[model samples]
Target: MEQDVSLGLAIFVEHGREREAADFYGSAFGARQFQAHHIDGALAGVEMRLGATVIAVAGANPRREAEPSRGGPFFPKVAGGVSTIIQLTVPDIDGCFAQAIAAGATLRDEVQTDVAGRRVASLFDPFGHIWVLIERDASAGRRAA
Candidate 1:
């Protein structure tokens, strides 16, 4: 059975880094590519699944820059300035963090327990998107019990 589309993210990667972003997501987050969109034999976009969530990855829209007033979406021009941050609740933060680093993610913050009792870390993929990896603190539940 196919899942109905609800909320999905469309990330416009930096110019010529579309494939790299897709690969990083696959290795670091266990995402699976289900579809690839092409234009005149060149890769245009990709659709991938991270668990049940779907994400669309594409190259920067040059048209948007030429038509500034026709604003929609465009590749991030500056690091640490991207408007959206992807948050993933994982079963193993340490393992996922290691995988992300190994896959070329730049560490923004080391894993640490937040005030809410969740272990969280942040990293930037090669393409400039910020990803927050989170793991619920098991000890908090044990303490409550």
Candidate 2:
């Protein structure tokens, strides 16, 4: 069954307040709750749909805490971090930036130009997850955020 399924991307977050985190994410990106499970008065898992992507969150598992780190080395916090970044492509950089800021995300960087002709900005959400917002030139097509 594992071989039959192709891997898509999803994020896993450990929240001291799982429901609060879920609500925040739901409000931030207009995410819709797809699935949820509760066990022992704690959230076991939740799946939310943000645009076309799926994100999963759950209470931290004590047994899985020993896994090796992943994510880019430049962001040390991202390595083995509970908060995982999810990028969004938007038509208006300034508008999206304002919305995110208003939704309780802290501005991490001012908008900057990349070599690939994209306007990009980074932000840290209320839950400490990192998100990169990208405005791509219609002419350039999609590359990387």
* Candidate number with greatest TM-score: 1
Q: Report the number of clashing residue pairs per model.
A: 0, 0
TM-score, candidate 2, is: 0.68
Q: What lDDT tens digits, residue by residue, belong to model 2 across residues 1-145?
A: 8767643444444535567667877766667888888888778667887776777766555445444453221222342244456688877888888877877778888888877878999887765677888995766555543
TM-score of model number 1: 0.87
Residues 26-59, candidate 1: write the lDDT tens digits. 9988999999998888888899999888999888
- How well does model 1 score by local distance difference test? 0.86
Q: CA lDDT of each candidate?
A: 0.86, 0.68
Candidate 2 residue-wise lDDT at 42: 71
Query: In model 2, which runs have C-alpha deviations exceeding 4 angstroms?
Result: 1-10, 62-85, 139-145
With a 3 Å backbone cut-off (N, CA, C), the pairs that clash in candidate 1 are none
